[model samples]
Structures are given as C-alpha cells and as structure tokens.
Target: MKLKTLASALIVSGIMSQTVAAAELEISVQNLTHGNQFTPILIAAHDGDSHLFQAGEMATPALQKMAEGGDIADLAAAVTGAGGVTSENPAGGLLFPGAHVDSIMLDTLTMTHLSVTAMLLPTNDAFVGLDAWEIPTEAGTYTLNLNAYDAGTEANDEIINGGGAAGTPGIPAAPGMDGGANGTGVMDGSSNDKVHIHPGVLGDTDPNGGASDLDSRIHRWLNPVARITVVVK
Candidate 1:
C-alpha cells in the first residue's frame, strides 16, 4: 500500500509540474534598429490556427490600424474575442532603438502558439511582426529574430503628415523627431497588395525637402529588426 501511494503521488506531482510549465511564460523584446522606434507592442498566445498577420495575405482592418498608426485596441479585442490571451504594450510606450523590454509575464493557459506585432515609427504601414510561432513544450529559453513587414494597405510615401488613420497616405509620426517635411513623395513601386517583407525605407539625404521625409543615414535598417526571447517556465 505504501509503494502504491508513493507512485501515485509522484505521477500527480509530474502532472502538476507540466501544467504550471505550460501556462506561464516570460518574454523579452529588443529593438535592433539604427534609428527606428516600435509602437506599443501587442503580444498574443493563441491556438495553432490563429494569426496576427500572415505573409502573402491581405492585411485585416485591425492590423492595418496598428500598422499605419500605433493603435492596438482593435487587434487586442479580436485576439481576446477568439479565446486568445494577450499582453498589450509591455514596454509602456515607444521602444526606441537599442532599447529592450524584459521579463514580460504572460499567463498563456492552454495556448500553444505566440504572435507579436508593433508598428515601426517613421515609416508608412511598416511593422515588426511575428506570426504564429509554436511554443516549445520543453521548459527552456528560446530566442527569435523578427523582420519588418509592409501591410501593403498604404503607399510608402515616407511623408510624416500625421496621417495615422487607416487607408491614409502618410506616416503617422516620427518618434525620433528626425523627420522632415515639404517635399515630394516616393511612389509605391510594388504592385503587391498583400502583407510582405518590407523593402526597407527609401529615405533621402535631404531632411528639409526631398523625395522622402526620412533621412537615409538616420532611418535606414536591415532585416531582422527585432529580437525576441521567450522563457517557458
């Protein structure tokens, strides 16, 4: 009887440990850009089928809102409505270049996948995105590098005109305060009207009056603009 009881207790303990490990997560993000800033980030944990935004697909209205502007309310609502768990704006505001937000606690509770999104400041409809990544069942730390994505809902004119509203024609804001004004616009060369890898910014040397309001030397960036760390505890 003693042996049987001990075996049962060990099994129960193992099950409890697995449950705890599956439900808790600690996440961190770093902006690995030269001069860009990330808007309020939205992190979500959901089932396998859900996605914040998929490449080669059209952008949803909620996603377009977040990409054009810095808004995440509609996207948060949609995630929660679909039975997903989310943590919004963990950094509390704009995540500047080389800045890192650490130890964001998220109780994922039965969710198996993770997704994160945030708009890149000083760019039109450009956002850093992580589509449904499978959460590891093993208890350990994992790191991921994310790329900038174009929502393809608006033109990349690179004009800073406070046009944050969806379907607007210009960039919402330049948090770095380095953007210029009073110039022509860069034409949207790509005909792809779907979410795709951003071709980076077409910033020019002129800060006062050029084809773009963004500065080529100050606002340019390569791929893998952000790095994410996940700890499954």
Candidate 2:
C-alpha cells in the first residue's frame, strides 16, 4: 500500500492478531538517541489483530493518554481486556539517552505478535514504537530498530508548559534539563491528524527566545530512535 493511503487505512490493516504457541520471551529495549527520553515502556505479547496505536488512523483515547501524558493506564486496560500479555514500565521511569532495560520476560499463551510503545518526552505527541512485530518460533535473539511516530493528535507547538493531558497544546516536559525556555512555538500544527511517521523535532539554538523551546544542539534526533532485541525461549 502507498504510504499516504496506509496512514488512513491503519485502522483496518492487520486488525486481527494471529495466535502463536506458548513461548517465553525475553525482551530488551535501548534508547539510541543522544537527547531524547522515553517514558515508561509498555511491552505486550498480543494477538495480531489489535494495536495500541495504529498508524494512519486516529489515536484511541487510551493511546492518546499515553502519547500525550506518558500515562498507559487505559491502553494497558484495553490490551489486557483483549487478553494480551503485558510488561509495564520495566525501566521504572524515564529511560534517558543510551539507557536500556533487559529484565523483561513474558510467557505467552495465545499471543503471537509483539507491540511496544512509549511517549518520547519533551515533545507534544512524539513516541518511539514497535507495532505488531511477529515473534519467531525459533529461539534466538532477534534485533529490530524502532521509529519515532507522531500520534497526530496534537500540534507540535514546541512549548514546554506541562500540558500533558490529551488535546493539550504544549509539550509536557524536556527532561534533559538542557532545553530552553520562554520561546515561541516552532510549527503551528500538523496537517495530518492521524497516526504517522514523525517529522523530527526542530529545535533552534536560541534558548531564551527561539522559534522552539528546545535546543537544536541537544534535542534533535534522526530516525531509528530505538534499538530492540527479543529472545524467544
């Protein structure tokens, strides 16, 4: 499918989860960016038909809560309600630059696909994610690189004013402590309001009064923001 069309079709594509044999999974996640921070990670072994957030589709209220405020309560509930297995917040808190978590393990029942998500802090609605990755039956370590995605539920206002609630217009935070303050917003808002690949952050050098409150030297990141390793046992 074409990329643009896929965005709008995300809701219907792969909407069914295929069940897999019961297997134990050992998962590890690494933040590859130099300046970004990941909120509590939500890892799941789920049927292939369901998703935390589907690209090219509107963000669910549960997903909006996670993407906007770093809260996973509703999404987790939805996943659990769908009979998916979950591992919540293995990092315990924000996973900062170069940080990693290797202690997560899951014993799958009917779950076959793996989905992972976490809000990328200091942005309005940016997140690093893995959407419905199939778990290999053979037991060996598998590596995957994840991308930064926009929930497309909010504008990229680039202001740091602690507005994390869904539909709020500013970034909840800049955990790096190197971000600037009292600056004007960079972009007005996104044209696309569905889930889609993120246009990376556009921070400027002027901290006190730049177009963005984020520092260009510290807050910018390219694609493939995270590296994930999965071990099937």
Candidate 3:
C-alpha cells in the first residue's frame, strides 16, 4: 500500500511540474502623452499571425469600436477566441498623461507574439497601437515605442460633443480638462479613408469659437505616443 501511494504522489508531482514549465511573461505599458488619456487597454499574447491593428489597412469592426468609443470588449473577445492569452483593461480605467499600467503575468508558452491597443482621448478615431511583436525566446527585458494611428473610420471633426459611438462625427470627451467649448470644428471634410498616422490636433488661440476645441500647445504630440517594456522569464 505504501509503494502504491508513493507512485501516485510521483505522478501528481510530474503533472504539476509540466504545467509550471510554461513560459511566463511580464508586460508594462506607459502613456507618454502629455495631455491625452488612454481608454481601456487590450494586451494579447498571440501567434505571429495575429495583429491588433495594421497601418494602411481597413480597421476591423472591433478596432473601430475601440478607436471610436473607447471600448475593448470586442477586441478582447476576438483575441480570446483565437487561443491567445489576454489582459483587458489593466489600468482599470483611463490612464492619464504620463501614467503607467502593468498587466497580470501572462503564461504564453504557445503564443509567440504580443499586441496592445488603446484609444487616445479627445480625438476622433485615433488610437495608440502595437501590432504583433515576436516575443524573444531568450529571457530578457525589451523596450518599444508605439505610435498613434488614425482609424480613418471617422472624419475627425474635432467637435467635443460626447459622441462616443462608431460612425460618430466628433470627439467623445477630453478627460484632461484642457479642452475648449463651442468651437467651429477642425475640418469640414476628411481626405483619408485608410488607417494612417495622426496629423496632430490643430487648435487656435480662440477657445470659445475656433477651428478646434483643443489647445494645440497642450494636446499636440509627436509620434511614439506610448512606451512598452516586456520581460520574459
């Protein structure tokens, strides 16, 4: 009886060891914007083929929802359905300017790449994104900077009217409390219909009635709107 019990114990220990052998990943996301805020962020560990967003490509329905409405449920669901590990909304809510958020440890033994995306507040269909990045097999720390991309799904009217739905014509909110009111709107038309880099907000000194509701000096940002660091162990 003692020998039989020992054999069973050994079998259980072996099974546990195998489960623990899976790869462990640590991901950190930092908002580099001086005035913008990031909506719920979506981090996924997927295969090389998976991409959260691609430049010059048509934005998916999920991507549109996220970029326009600050919603990440659809994207997270899509990633989860693809046999990928996901950390949804690690920040719990809006990540303010110059803030950082860390996700839970993701065990990605099978998934080999990582992707992340979040909407830039006070803008029309603009988002900070990182497409599929090959996670190094060798354990180490890696850093990357991300750029802001225009969803090209909306016309960027720059009118802050609480419009946070897909196909909306104006910005939803300016969480930084630096926005103006009753502006004339940025442009009357949009020339680009494909995803591309954001041209930055155009604001005039007149806040009560101007071409933009945002302050150009406070809201404008260059490329690489976010910084990401990944540690694999």
**What shift in Å separates residue 182 of candidate 2 from its native position after superposition?**
1.1
Q: How high is the lDDT of residue 84 in model 1?
A: 92
- Per residue, candidate 1 scores C-alpha lDDT tens digits across 1-233 of 99999999999999877753556899999999999999999999998899999999999999999999989999999999999999999999999999999999999987889999999999999999999998988889999999999999998998999999998889988999999898599987899889999999989999889899999999989999999999988
- Candidate 3, residue 47: the lDDT equals 78
The candidate maximizing TM-score is 1
By the lDDT metric, which is better: model 2 or model 3?
2
Better of 1 and 3 by lDDT: 1
Between prediction 1 and prediction 3, the one with superior TM-score is: 1
Runs off by more than 4 Å, candidate 1: 1-21
Clashing pairs in 3: none
- Model 3: how far residue 125 lies from native, Å: 0.8
Q: Which of 1 and 2 is the better model by lDDT?
A: 1
lDDT score for residue 217 of model 2: 81
Cα lDDT, model 2, residue 116: 93
